[model samples]
Target: MSEQSPLDLAEGDPFGPHNLPYGVFSTPDAPEHRRVGVRIGDHVLDAGAAAHALGSPYAALLARPTLNPLLAAGRTAWRDVRRALTAWVTVPAHRPDIEPLLHPLDTVTLHLPYEVSDYVDFYASEHHATNVGRIFRPDGDALTPNWKHLPIGYHGRSGTIVVSGTDVARPQGQRKAPTDPAPVFGPSVKLDIEAEVGFVVGTPSALGSPVDLASFEDHVFGLFLLNDWSARDIQAWEYVPLGPFLGKSFATSVSAWVTPLEALTAARVAPPERDFPLLPYLDDADAEVPGGFDIRIAVALNGQVVAEPPFAGMYWTAAQQLAHMTVNGASLRTGDVYGSGTVSGPERDQRGSFLELTWNGTEPMELPTGKRTFLEDGDVVTMTAWAPGPDGVRVGLGEVTGRIVES
Candidate 1:
């Protein structure tokens, strides 16, 4: 499917899908610092070193000491960098602009893409919502009174968002036992992972300024892989009149690279048919069947693939989510990230989280080696995404992986 290279891409290869997403990394030898780079096949193309060779805005940002400049530069800068990098890495014959900064993938430390000011996770998946709703309310009216009319979201803790390779600590909170009326706080036993995608906010919106669907594209800088680990028991007890607080606030992991919207152009497709017609502010005048993106997404345990799904599985489009977020005049700043809630499909195996996939631990998943109710200590859960393109698969987002640590 890759138009650029006829090379066979091992399922595990990071760049073979033609994704050139950017990130910051430093090897174990240099753990204290982070440098910019992009994923190509299994290797990382160093961006900081490459910037010196290319006369682009990224080079200027790379020349700076920190990634703050790059993050603050917004959507325009991100597009320019991606366009230049795509051309340089794929067709280097004519553009002699970038040649020096390329380096091997192993020598770097991948850091969180941006200094997130605030994190908001949305309930965007229809199947996931219905499944979760059935658990809470059995009457089949899984959707809340306001769910269909608007995009519902909960603000999460930003300090806890970690990059790949980081260890996620098991969280603890209050939960009402099967027999007991009182609540107890303790280590979360039902810890699970949620397969999600996070969009980085490039431009800042002024307070009280409503964002319309037509102008929503401009505010989005790019997309990245996200895994919002959950403490089901803790969440059950804590989520009452209000939504997730301690259960969700503890840790949220995301991929280091940000895939600019432009790179996914070819893969854009119309979203699933809406359950109901959207309000005027949320309507997209010109949207095709795949207008959003057909990025193939999956989650793996250790090195084994667990759930293989596609981005096309999402019920609500990202543009609709962004527009809904700003409809109330809520100001969005640079580095603000929005999460596409757990992406799930109609099939049981295609479920994104262990709770849904394993039927809330009622049914354990049988791996090739064994079975698992939830992630165990040293178990690494990775979420990877990419799009098939005319020229090789245009690889954008990388994996968001984390090993479960001891309590």
Candidate 2:
């Protein structure tokens, strides 16, 4: 029998030809020489090298250390490059030249794929918002009066964004208890994680022009798993008049692999029904493409499964969020990222954050590792997810993980 080729991926492999997520990597032999790579099964294809070997026109875009150039190329180029990549891997004639450029996945080190220009995170899940409100304002309405009208978001610190496997130091800030007459300074005792899906912008929009809901696909390049680490104590004390600050600005983690939006065609679904009429700019009643995605997220703490948040149940869609974001004429730039905030479902096991899962520590969770209310030093949090793909296959979003260390 002949030796099986690395390109000959087994059936139903999430990283098959149908799903060629991109990343940046460097081999141990040349640690500083990073190049763009595509995940295919168990191997990473040296995208730039393969493009040069196959005499592909996209060599200029692929032969780079980061994904920003390709992202700035706009939607048409993105489609063309994806088509060419699909052919390069699926077509037998190109296999000989492409085979040699393939590298074992374990032999390379993955890095942050792009230089993020800006970061914004949205509170778009109704279930999550309601739970948070109920926990904090027990006697008041769970849903805020303005919650249904627009996607509430806050600008986040882009400098703290890190790639998967990075360790995060516990942040120190001010916190106050009802019994205390004043606030105290110390490391966060209520460390938590918010499971989210993030969208990466590919094209830039003018500073004065608003991007409508219909232009979402034209600007977004891909999607990935994100962990918006939070310090509940710090946030509760600081986020009074304004939104999240030091608690959220400390660190955020993202997956190395960015799955192209085109590969998620089958995952499109209708978002949860709205209870109130939306404004003209944020409305999607007559939109051609469905706004919701059927991506299922699994969040684990210390290697044990704790929550499974459903992305499809989100109240606001990415398109609406983009439209709302740019409605004020805020310019879009390549490498800009926005997160679909804590994706929780109606069930208890579906809550995406420790705040909701443990009811703000009023209840403790029983795990094999012992009882827990919030993250502890040395605790590792990991998130992984998959979306429906074409022909019954699955499109996997790369996992994002981080370990908490002492401040």
> For this target, which candidate reaches the highest lDDT against the unseen true structure?
2
The TM-score, computed over Cα atoms with residue i paired to residue i, of candidate 1 is 0.89
Alpha-carbon deviation at 20 in model 2, angstroms:
0.6
Residue lDDT tens for model 2, 144-235:
89999999999999999999999999999999976889999999999999999999999999998999999999999999999999999999
Model 1, 153-190: lDDT tens per residue? 88999899988778998887787756887988778888
Clashes of each: 29, 0
Give me the displacement of residue 398 in model 1, in angstroms.
Answer: 0.9
List runs of model 2 lying over 4 Å from the truth.
Answer: none
- The TM-scores of all predictions, comma-separated, are 0.89, 0.99
lDDT of each: 0.75, 0.95
The Cα error of candidate 1 at residue 329, in Å, is 1.0
The best candidate in terms of TM-score:
2
The true-versus-predicted C-alpha distance at residue 169 of model 2, in Å, is: 0.4
Report how far residue 56 has shifted in candidate 2, in Å. Answer: 1.1
- CA deviation > 4 Å runs, candidate 1: 1-18, 27-33, 54-58, 65-67, 90-100, 285-291, 391-396
